[model samples]
Structure formats: structure tokens, C-alpha cells
Target: MYALIVIISIIFFISCLLFLDYQLGKRNHIKNLRFLDFEPTTGDYNLYTNGDQLFTDLFDDLRHAKKQINVMFFIVKDDDISHELLELLKKKAQEGLRVRLMVDRIGSFRINKATVKQLEQAGIEFTFSSTPKFPFLYYRIQRRNHRKITIIDDEIGYVGGFNMGQEYLGRDAELGNWRDYHLRLIGDVVKDLQITFFDDWYLNTGESYDHIPEPTSEGSKEVEITSTDGGQLEDVFMTLIQQAQDEIFIGTPYFIPSERLMKALLSAMDRGVDVKVIVPMKADHLFVKEAGLPYLSRVRKAGGEVYFFDLGFYHAKVIIIDQELCDIGTANFDRRSLFLNKEVNTLIFNKRFVMDLRLAYLRDVQDSQPFDDHYTQLFNLGTKIRIGLAYLVRPLL
Candidate 1:
């Protein structure tokens, strides 16, 4: 019994030490790789607000795709956009386009394999990313390819928080007023997106970037691809959050920011910079909503203003600073988005995009509702206590 107890204690001590070492290594890695090399003096970039025109552009790129079409998404539901895009993809595949797609085994949960089998039968290659379809064992399979990305003909790329969903496009009656931003990328940066796509594709299909992403003289002069976070890579978005100066404005449907981000925001506020945040009045996730309230309350007390868009559930993720730096992609502020989910975000240091985003801020402000402490007044002590405790595990959200 004594020997067994000692062995157990030894194992526990080693585990704790390993975890601490991992955390320290992660911190150092983040410090080293988070800030991507963006030439502040390079490129004239444009930003897109609505999905209609962006979808048209995406379609145009697909129509032009001759050699390859690579796409990877967390979720591909049976929405109008998905169907239309799939039909277009099928047509291209029929026309001898080397079309390939990767869907998350975890996120493409509700979607049936039969839905995509037709494309496979039509010669379009398809694969699933880290799919776990078990019972209690499935819960442990938490890491996911949460990125929503599409690369057309290896030239044009798309990334943002807007998944191929009706709610994201704000067309469905159920989602009357969701707001999101996606970049229609056409540049060398598309290579980064393609690299990301290839990485996910190979994780499932064993195909390299050479097989999926063909080199071309054609690249987007406007922007380049920057990563948010990959499995063990530093979260570039978090680094960007820390780089805020003069002004900081964020619009994310899920607003559960990490403690590091929260501290940065509060510190920025403390510096007297005008900071404004917008989130959904009604998030699609219930536990997230409950968890987010306490943070908002804390933020409000810290001289920050929180606006909740009541028109509908807004799924947009944007962060603009000083009308100079802007990023629009499918990343949210929460831990699931930042650390666990396979998310992507681009950094655009273009004056034009930032200026236009300022305008978007105006439109979003017009449509959003303000959140006050009044909503929490009805909550009793027990509920408040639960919310406070829920935040302790925010790192795992």
C-alpha cells in the first residue's frame, strides 16, 4: 500500500510538472511567432461588408479556377449558400477541375455524408478533419478545424467568421440582423490560406501543399495570409489584440475573451483610449451567454461600453484599431474560437479597409442594442454565483 501510494504521488507530481512546462513553452512560443511580418507600407486593400457581393466574387473565382479548388470548413450545413456553392463546385468538378474539400469530423456533425457523396462520385476529392463520432469518448475529441476557408483555383481565398449559413448571411427570418465580415483575398497571402488548407487536408488525406496548392504567377496584391492559431502555433489574433493603440473596437458574436485579452482591453481602457465592444443580445450558445455576462459587467465597471445587437444574432468578428489596422475572418473572441477551434483571421493594415470599417462601425452601431446591468437585476444570488464560477474555466470554454 505504501509503495502504491508513493507511485501515485510520483505520477501526479510528474504530470503537474509537465503541464507547467508546457504552459511556459507555450508562452515563449507565443511571444516568438505571434506577430506576423506585415509591411505597414505595402498593399492597398479593400473590405467587404455584405455576403451577397462577396459570394458573387467567390463564385467568380471558382468559375475561373482551372487547375485546383481547395476548401476546408468547420461546418457545411444545407443552407442556400452551401447548396449553391456545392452545385457550382460540382459543375467545375464535372468540367475537370481538381476540386478538393475538407470538412471537420466534429463540426460537420449534423451534415450527413450522403450530402457530399454526390461530389465524391463526380470525381471531386473530399475528406473529414479529426472526426470523432463516438459517445462519451467523443467529448474528449475537442480539437476541431473551426476555420471557414475557401480557396478558388489556388488564387483567390476567403476567410472570416461568416460560415456558409443562412443565419450568418442575415437572410433567414430566424436571423434577421446578424453581422459578419469576410475577406475576398487575391494575393500571395492566399498561399498562407492554401498552406492552412493543405495542412488540414493532409492531416486527413495525406496530400501535401504541392498536390493541393499549385504555384501561380497570379496572387492577390491586396493582402497576405496570416494565421490565427493552428494546433500548437501561437494565436496571432491574441497578439494583435495586445498591439492595440489609440483606439480599439471589436464586434464578435461570441465575446468570451481570454484573460490576457481581457487584461489588454482593460489596460487600453485605463490608458483613456476610446474602446467600444459589440456582441449579440442573444447568442446561439446558452452557456456562453451565461458566462459572457459577468465579463461584460466587469468591463462596464471598468469604463467600457457593451452593446448587444437585439435585431438578431450577430456572428461577425472584427477588430479595428485607430482606423488603421483591421482584421476580418471567421474568428470569435472566445476560448473555443481562439485556442481549441481551428480558426483563421487575416491582418489588414490598409488605410482604405480601416476607413471603410469605421463606416461599418456606424452601421453596426445603428443596428445594435446596448447592454446595461439592468438585465442582471432579475437574477437571484444562486444564478449570479453560478455565472461567476463558470468563468473560472474560461480557459477551457
Candidate 2:
């Protein structure tokens, strides 16, 4: 009895310490939040669903870069394709062009010290973003820079879900036929992308560039770049949902939304909006799919459609509303994206672009299976327990 009492006391004391840490972390995060809302700019944009095509165009742009190249990604795996990209950047840097590469410290943990030395030797500037520090260690560890963007010569930009990996090129045996959405852009929006990249670079390196090129219209399509550092994302998503009058379509690898965002989605359905969501049938992370089960079930019950994409690992982060405006970028429709990560998304306000994206969404849906009652009924005792745990620690997911 004495030993048992001591163990209980220890557990209670550790739990209280953790609770205090969490509260302090929350306060610190709110105090340092940053959000940016760029004005709508005219730009020419091409959406790439094929990874091969995207990298081909991107590599070509890198090769043609005249003055500078800035690249950032959440993950840059130590794989064949990543090596190819690093080599290209090294060549560019050696040619006296400014080259900077930034990757998330945690997401790209596979990038070792030897690679950093190689990059530096080649005159390429490299740094890791969102490295965990003191103050709020636990909270800081959870906060990631989830934005994936590239700017070349302050004229061309690439943004979307594609990271530098062979898996992204549909070579992973476990996740076959990788499907995602990415954008290649030119014109005024490229300047916005550069500004976003500069902001992140400044945060990590304390280096700032003063020669941001002036905006020039390249196309008629209107676009707004929204960057968030664990702030204002929920409100942005809520406003997008609340303004929908005809339909809503979302595609994400994770679906664990905040309570308010979920409620707004359901309310959109209640008001006659045709709401649809697509998620992966296979989970890449632990407890993520299970966490979304309850929310997906509720969406189905409320006449909103849910799809499980079985063709491949669906990693597209997109939302289309009323075939009028759409969001596409690194932000997932999950709590981590909506409340914790540093993310960037493009709000495109062109009907033609929206319809094109909507068509692609439907194509993906046709390749998916419905999230019906039978699907929910397939959960067993273990899965149900995981679902409960997922809810208990959802903010961290």
C-alpha cells in the first residue's frame, strides 16, 4: 500500500507539471502569433496533379534562374530526387547566383550534418526552420513550419503539397500513385510568395533582403496569399465555409478540425450547401485517421458526403466553395494546420480555376469509396479506444 501510494503521488505531480507547461506554452504562442493577408494580385497559375510534371517544370525554372533562388519545404527526404535538387542548387550557387534552401528541422530530420556541410561548401545557404528551443519546449517542439514554397528570381513561384522526395513522385511501394495538388505561378503573386519566404528566412537566419521586386501582372487570374503562424487560420476557414452558398469540397490527408470549424461545416450543410470531403483510406501517421472518424461520421449523418481515397495516399490540401473561390496550399484541414503550424495558402478567386479544381475533386471522389455506416461499423474495440485517445490529445494532433 505504501509503494502504490507513492507511485500515485508521483504520477499526480508529473501530470500537474505537464499541465503547467501546457498553459505556459499556450500563452507564449498567443503572444508571438503572426498572420499575413496579402492583397489580391493578378497572376498566371498552372495546377499540377502529376509530381513528375511539377518537378520537371520546377527544375527547369531553377536551371533558368538568373539572380536568386529561394526554396523551402516541410520535408526534404534524403532520397534520389532530393539529392538531384540539392545538386542543382549547388551548381546554381557555384555559378554566383544566390541560392537558399530551408527545411523544417523535424520534418526533414533525415538531412544530416554532412549534407549541410556539402551545401555550405557549394556556396548554398541552408537553414532549418522551426527548430525547437527552450521557454516552452514541449509546445515549441510541436510547432512546425508546414509551408512548402519556392521563389526563383522573384518572378516565378511554386507552392503546394509536393515535397522533395521519391515518394512524392509515386515511387513509394506502400503509398503507390501519390496524388497531390501544386501550383506554378508567375506575376504579382510571385512577389507575395517571395515576401512569405523572406519572412520565414528572416525568422530563422535574421537575414533580410531589401530588393523585393515590384509586382507585375502576368495574367488575369486573381489570387491572395495567406500566411499564418498558428494564428487566424480557424477564422479564415470558418469564413470560407460560412460564405458558401452552393457547395463546399475539401481534400486533406488529416481531418481532425477544431470544434468550431466542424460546427461551421455542419451548419453549412444545414443551410443547403452541398458539402463533400475526401480523406485517405491509408493513414501515414498514428491516430490521425482514427481521430477523424467521429467527425467524418457526423458529417455523413448530416447529409455531407465523405470519401476514402483508395487509389493512393491522398495528400491534397484544398477547399472549393460555390465554384467561385478555392484555397490550395500547404495547410491541411486539421487542427495542426488550423491552430499549430506555420502554413501558407493561396486563395484563388477565379471561377475557371475553381471549376477546374472542382472537376479534379470529383475525379478523385470517383476513385474513392463512400464513408458509409458500414465503414463506421467496421471499427473494432482497439480502434474505438484509439479514437477516444485521439480526442483526449487532439490539440497535439
Which one wins on lDDT?
2
The residue-by-residue lDDT of candidate 1 on 27-91, one tens digit each, is: 54355433233332223334566767777777888888887788877777787888887888888
Per-residue lDDT over 223-325 for candidate 2, one digit per residue giving the tens place of the 0 to 100 score? 9999988868998899999999999999999999998998999899999999999999999889999999999999999999999999989999999999999
- lDDT per model vs. reference: 0.70, 0.92
How much is the lDDT of residue 69 in candidate 2? Answer: 94
Local lDDT at 161 for model 1: 67
